[model samples]
Target chain A: MTRASISSPKPALVAAAAALSTICLALAPFVVREGDLRLMIEIFAVFTFAQSWNFLAGYVGLMSFGQQLFIGLGAYFVFLISGKAGINPFLLLPLSFVFCAAFAAVCAPFVFRLRDAYFAISIWVIAEVVRMFISQKDWLGSVSGLPLVATRGMDRTVVANTTFYFVAALALISVFGLYALSRSRMGLALAAVRDNEGSAAAVGINVWWTRFFGFVLGSGLAGIAGATYYMSVFHVEPGGAFDPNWMVIMLFIVIIGGVGTIEGPIIGTTIYFLFRAWFAGTGNLYLMLLGAAAVVTMLVAPKGIWGVLRSRLGFELFGTRRLGPTNHRSSP
Target chain B: MPPVLQADRLSRRFGQIVVADELSFSVDHGQCLGIIGPNGAGKTSVFNMLAGVIRAQSGHILLNGADVTTKAQHERTRLGIGRTYQVPQPFGQLTAFENVLTAASFGGGRRGQDAADHAASILDRTGLSKRSDMPAGALPLLDRKRLELARALALSPRLLLLDEIAGGLTEAEVNVLVDLIAAIKPTLAIVWIEHVTHAVSAVADNVVAINFGKKIAEGTPAAVMADAAVQEVYMGAVMDVAAVG
Candidate 1:
């Protein structure tokens, strides 16, 4: 609550809070049930996805509709390589990030030529192309999915706990890592570019390269989270892996939680899962309810649930506001 | 040394409307050149060309004797050319301090404590020290204008382009701005395009008048203001220029 204040908490207070959070996270796997552990892993993976997209939409001033591209590419990279090379898929998680980053770097020049919605839609088009290419490649699985080749008979609890650890690390990175990045020099550049590209250029920030860096970083984070996700299911296929619905869920979590704040995704992910638990059985109604919730949130508090909370509380949990209008709280 | 900035035979057109027509000028070190024209006379287009926001269809732009005609806008800024927009475009989400700090580090190429101190000095220099922590988007017009100037100065520019920075300020504020520019005038070259004629006349070492993108008059501020061609281009130039005070 004090973090919402203009004056950041003392360094000692910050360090203490960080230590506390680390202890709680380390203790969770020991006490949690296997089913609940799997659920928590999904929640963290989804939260990481939302956080990455939030970073893109808010700080980097990019709205990409093709985030699923990296998600599918990440899942496929681990699946195909692990099945053929017999290396543990978990061992290849870092490589998944590398593959996605390299892909984003290659696509940046072509996609960057378009601005706003066109730029966003071009990414979606690329994802579709790649999905189609993979669907036709027999070695890549065709229509049937590939199973986890190595570590198939590993202890169930061990596999679950290991996945939980990786997802937990990623979730923490999405929060603290993103906050630190936003406070860095490159963060200042990202904010300038987000607010106005013309002014950023005039100030000598290389607008293209700055945006390129953000795109690559966000894509890499999403890639790793996606790998952790599919690795748990032990199956990787084109249809579900590259599904645009993944983009929809990510967009929903970010927009409903607050597009830019790290804390927003946490609150949003909680609400999203609750809504899913209650409404998932409603078939198309579940999606419609999600759509309606988004519209209402946009209409009421365009900044999202966290935005409203921050405004009311007069403090931000993880305020790395590098772009948009700053809300002024009246001094008493 | 060669002139700090030189625009040789700059020409451009939008379809049939010529925005710049064989325009040529130079400003030596420590000089101020004022450009004045009617609302649509392409005064800003000239500044845009100089700032590399827009390229000239023909001719060359030289900074310190090197041709910079093909360079990008950010590259031009790094090479010691800094500019302000007609409408102040401060990074709204950032505090006034961060705005200038970004320019100091990126544009001025300073590092660490140097950049921080430089940013503080610029904010103080622009009379924005008290509002250093305030978000720039919430600042009033005068402060925003000052911030615009401060951000440009943070670039440690060899040449500064001022595009109507004084447009929306009050009489007192404009005078304050004039004083600030005059104090800094000895260190670098400046090309200022403004409709606030009196403000221009106060700080301009030299003046040029243009209409339809062609230079109609160029001489001492008083001499150019008194030119018949300039007077015709701006029938109100004499009365309006003298009346602002």
Candidate 2:
């Protein structure tokens, strides 16, 4: 019976889901309003950002305070390269991942020496430094910002639709990609490291490399999503692109939704978007309300909403658990 | 032939506390070395040194005659040093199968079906087959201890270090665990630090007793337990060697 579960029809379900998502992606541009499409693009990008951080904090046991560092860098990479090369911003999405990943790789050796909260703050410091550096550079539009030069003359509908498709693709990949990752050997390694470093090492896992891989992958995903977000806006500045607000949004979503479970962030992101939509008119009050929601969720459901729901409902979507064999034999 | 594992005059101290006082021992394949010591006598610390979790201040660890003192913990694990914690340290969120599977995959260097099969077999051997589906964190204390042993075996190590695996178990449970260890006793060299002396004597061919991080007795289990100095060390302890045997 347990063996049967390993060969379950999860593949068929995933294929069907992917097909439906692609179909929706194809049709949404035509059916959805321009403003709504813009909103959808931002929602997907923001969710992807939350999901990547969730992977790092929950899956890999690394809490990073400077996630905005990647966001700003990703946006900067897209705007700067597209402006100078006269290339479509959409064409440069993958490079944003490479650049952020490389930056993380270079930072890991030094940053890893500081553990837990210190490691988190070190990245934030790096983000602040990069933001200041970008703020001072005149040619890179330091203070002012740069526009998507390639998209300036393109048809408004064409640009929005294309951005939707690209951002939508990134969103789909983040979800399915995270699910697939959570089931792999590396996922088990990450879980082990997160649970206990001594046990992880005793079990022959290279704890350092496992964490480094997670950090790079999570940061790279954030970079890709950040680029997609800025591409939708058609402008990127040092302050807005590298804003600490990105960290706040991610933390609020992941914390209130669920810290570890993939489904938790999905639920959390939806709630966050709704809260924003409902409170959009209240200006700064919305941020305060978001904080209240998080505090209440913590008091009521410390594990997040999905975590509570999962315990009560026993519904599992992407958990990497393999239950024991059921006693299927008949008794006389 | 060189013993499967040999510790040569290992010494380690934490500030003013000496946890290992020039400790030296050897266990060859098919041999079991039962280490008995009072609490804070550095028994677990010795296991930690052997597993490379903690490096000794000055000593050499030889695995099959290869000096492994400078190797990283996981490197030592890959070189066939597997250990269980005094208090079971499992990947709590992972199922029992996953705890073993991770070790088989990374430590044992097995992959795919091989790792799975090995993990399953280890679970069966450790009498955790019925609980393999449950998360390690959710398991009862007895099963958690069994899971620790199962995870260590998953490494397929040449030298197995059992740290208080029999502690906090009923006599019946301890007997079952002893039976399991005895059945596989000849396949690997085992260094077991156990408070339950009878559980140690049941399978141990030889025994060493430590006091304040120094070896005070070494001989057959019966001989070491009868040692006057070992008895002296246990005078103020809650569990005495004579009562257990």
Candidate 3:
């Protein structure tokens, strides 16, 4: 039986569900008020960052504890270009991608040399090194950080900028786009390599090339996230830019949502933000509760929240494109 | 004549313990060669050297009489060498068809719909037509073996290397595997390193036996199986199978 004819919900039904989600988001600002609107935009930023992290760790079998290195650097690059150099902030976004990609290219050989846990720890060390170096920069505001704008009056447009930025974030997220990209030929190669590197090489795959491309692409996305996140926050510093809390948030999202599929990040980010709102007044108890919940979820649903839902529904919300019918037979 | 693939004086060492030593062998075009050996006799090392995953300590490897000793694994694959592992390894998350599609696209240099068709046909030939859309990890033992064959075949290899694919299968499964190997014989040369004596004998045109990284016998399967030294190395196990003769 082909997936196309597998008695799934009608396209209209799926479209209606998507339309409802869009409508909900569109009306959220009016119903939830300004503070909640700003919070929701922040949540979208977190989702973008987490999904990129999920792409690297979940699909590539890479655990990068130092993703903040790129995210922080991208934030700083945009802050420097826009705040100090007086360039339009939007122009500085793509420039951050280029800079982060170049850095990954230079660092690929060195970082790729390390295996497993060593690779994870090495990346974390690299991030700390970068953070410390930036912390010592007097002109860049050192530990105190820098204002994202030179004057108070120009910054009055922050609300509109944040709103427009959220729209752009949602557009770029485009779950279907990510799903299509991840199901392409390159994605298959990456999945094979991730499953078994030695076998992948034996079958004529360039394992290194597959992994390096995934790493670089993932880093670029993280950088883009950092740039946009800085605009949302309206400031940049070593502490805020290199916040390990963002890493914690991302890991929780991927772990709680589902690491490998596109839906995981979306589902994860929504659940995470909801929990945050529910427990905001609990102080350290909130963080402790999140930690306990993450551990419990991982233990109970190791594939993450999306995996649970997919299993229950017998659906692949995120999957490859269909060109024609598939001839699937049961093995005897 | 220049052989289609030639490995001269190939050697491998793991810090003083030699796995392969000064081994020289050649596979001519459209020739099926069987390699038999005791456990850990380094038959897979030869395959690894030919496929370019591990470099030989000192040797010249020529593909179609052109040196490819230092080429990368993917480059060697593009040049028409494909291999299956002793233990079949398929992408657990991908469907069997998707796994083969990757081989067609990246290894065989095809693209899009053509690559998909190439993969599907390869799967059909390998008896995996029914399980194409099933996740590879969910497939049974025999299907997993077929997935490995399908993956290698999807590359449209000029030289196909099989590594102990029948090692753990039942006698019946071995027979099915042998038939499949025989069916593909006309189009591609095969180098099958197998532990299952009968299966190798059933398919190989010629057989070479190795002991301690050195060739012990080379000839027809029946002749090699009957050789005193070849029988001696099997440590009396072949004596029981001798009744089949």
Per-candidate clashes come to 2, 1, 0
Residues B1-245 of candidate 2 have per-residue lDDT tens digits of 99998999999999999999999999999999999988899998888888887899998999999999989999999999999998889999888888988898899998766777778778877888777767799999999999989999999999999998999999899989999999888899999998888889888988999977899999999889888998888887664455445
Chain A TM-score of each model, in the order shown? 0.93, 0.94, 0.86
Put down candidate 1 lDDT per residue, A6-101, tens digits, no spaces. 222333444565678778888899998888888999999999888989999998999999999998889899988988998888899989999999
What DockQ, between 0 and 1, does each candidate earn? 0.45, 0.56, 0.48
Estimated TM-score for each candidate: 0.94, 0.95, 0.92
For candidate 2, report its TM-score.
Answer: 0.95
Scored by TM-score, the top model is 2
- Top-DockQ structure, candidate number: 2
Off by over 4 Å in 1: A1-12, A321-332, B236-245
Q: Give the TM-score of candidate 1.
A: 0.94
DockQ of 1: 0.45
Writing each residue's lDDT as its tens digit, candidate 3 over B75-193 gives: 89989998898888888877788778778888888877777777777876788877777888899999999889989998999889999999889988988988999989778888899
lDDT per prediction? 0.87, 0.87, 0.78
